[model samples]
Target: MVTRRRLPRAFFERPTLQVARQVLGQRLVRLEPEGGRLAGLIVEAEAYVGSEDLGCHARAGRTARNASMWGPPGHAYVYFTYGMHWMLNLVTEREGFPAAVLVRALLPTEGVEVMRRRRRGRPERELTDGPAKICQALAIDRELDGHDLCNPDSRLFLEAGPGVPEQAVTTGPRVGLNSVAEPWKSIPWRFQVRPEYIPSLAEEEQTP
Candidate 1:
């Protein structure tokens, strides 16, 4: 078992880009109600800093849906989109400052059987390769919106995991924002672990 230390609130209270970069290779664990822990290594994430960034949810100002983003650091900021899918984000920065890191993809580690089952036998590659898909695989929804990720006793939390070297990290523009304009749209806020550095199951083979 990977003896991962739960990340502290200070880990998230750092600058948005730093949080996004450091999050890669960290463990995202969910204490499943029916089984043991369902966990995965965070592989991709995007940073949204403050209300000035047009792509951030705070761009439209704080509402009931995005209030969590403006609250304490190291909290879940889950939101529903496409009328059906849920996206997971981590709140960053000090209280009242709206900065967040969107977890874009994960590489299944522990309790993959449970995740595969929840995904209804979808191919391993599709299991948690997208933001909405990760939520589906972990059964996260609006109820987890304000959950504290820094709490050791929480059902869901982040932990120190596989280390990703600088050579194995990549950055690019955040995706799925075709409607947004320049600067923000082109900012290279997306962080990902290179394929070669990921575990074999994630890139070299299909999930069985």
Candidate 2:
């Protein structure tokens, strides 16, 4: 059973990489306008640290779109990308620091039917298998940009859940950085649960 205890701001006021890994096995929940909940078990995430990281959005400094990243920790940094998809990111580190963790994948545990419907009747395995897919499944968009995740009344918040052991976690380079520079492109900042820990995608979505 997952605890309803929402993660406090202090939980995110840490190194970006640390927050990314620690978020694994937690619960990402969205409370719909009608009071329904769409939640999942966080299983994959990527870290983007500071303005110096070439692969990070803050590399170019703050802008209107990324203003939320410069806000206090424990706030949502939702952004639209590729002219189509909305991505969900959680800001981390101290205020004014542009650091955040990109939530990459989730295992649907609540509101599976709604997720499947939002995902266009896709199978359970495909409902929230990727970053963009997770947003789509949960109906997250610019509306929640900079939303305070630590607020008890917030529609979007994270909950404490089972902690994933180090042995069950894996690290690798983030996806989709073809044009990014070296070192940053290959940095092992992406974190995910080992294949054996997840049921659906373990065999169907093998990774190198």
Candidate 3:
């Protein structure tokens, strides 16, 4: 059986890079207004550490747009970008610290039809494949910014899933940072595991 256990606040109160790697194989869950549960297996993540990391938003220091990053761990530090797309980042490490793991992609496991409709019928594999697409597919936006993910009563939260072994993971530099200088640009902060590494839930266990 696929158990749905909420990850504790302590899970995110660790180093940013460690949280990024460990988040893979966990499930992002959104309890919809229509009383449906939408969830997916997180497959990719990228860590952006504190202010000294030039490639990170915190590099500019904490501004109104990024204030949530300085809040308690296990909260969502969602933001808008490209004047259109919304990106979701889960705050990590100590309170007042600006560090988070950007959720990059997911393997949709529940409420697939709802996600497809929200994505306007994109190909199955394309849904929730990117950070923006994940926000789009799950209806995550700025309204969810600063939301406490560790709260079971909250509409959005994360659940433990199958553990992805270290050997199955691949790491690389964060994507879309052409303007960033070297070192930060080249650092292996992104981590991912192939979808096959995630075991499929039985049909009965997949009902949302």
Highest-lDDT candidate: 3
How many steric clashes between backbone atoms does each model show? 0, 0, 0
- Report how far off residue 99 is in candidate 3 (Å): 0.2
Please report, as a residue range, the 10-residue window in candidate 3 with the lowest summed lDDT.
Answer: 198-207
**Model 1 CA deviation exceeding 4 Å by range:** 200-208
Q: Write the per-residue lDDT of candidate 3 for residues 1-208, one digit (tens) a residue.
A: 5798999999999999999999988889999998999999888999999999989999998899999999999999999999999999999999988999999999898889999999999988899999999999999999999999998699999998875888779999999989999899999999988656655422324545
**lDDT for position 23 in model 3:** 95
Candidate 2, which ten residues in sequence have the lowest lDDT sum?
Answer: 199-208
Give the true-structure RMSD of model 3: 2.1
lDDT tens digits, residue span 52-126, model 2: 999999999999999999999999999999999999999999999999999999988888999999999999999
Q: Scored by CA lDDT, what does every candidate get?
A: 0.90, 0.90, 0.91
lDDT of 3: 0.91
The per-residue C-alpha lDDT of model 2 at residue 70 equals 93
Kindly report which residue pairs in candidate 1 clash with one another: none
Q: What is the C-alpha RMSD of each candidate to the true structure, in Å?
A: 3.1, 4.6, 2.1
Candidate 1, position 175, lDDT: 93
Error of 1 at 175 (Å): 0.9
Q: 14-74, model 1: which lDDT tens digit per residue? A: 9999999999888899988865888888999999988899888899999999999999999
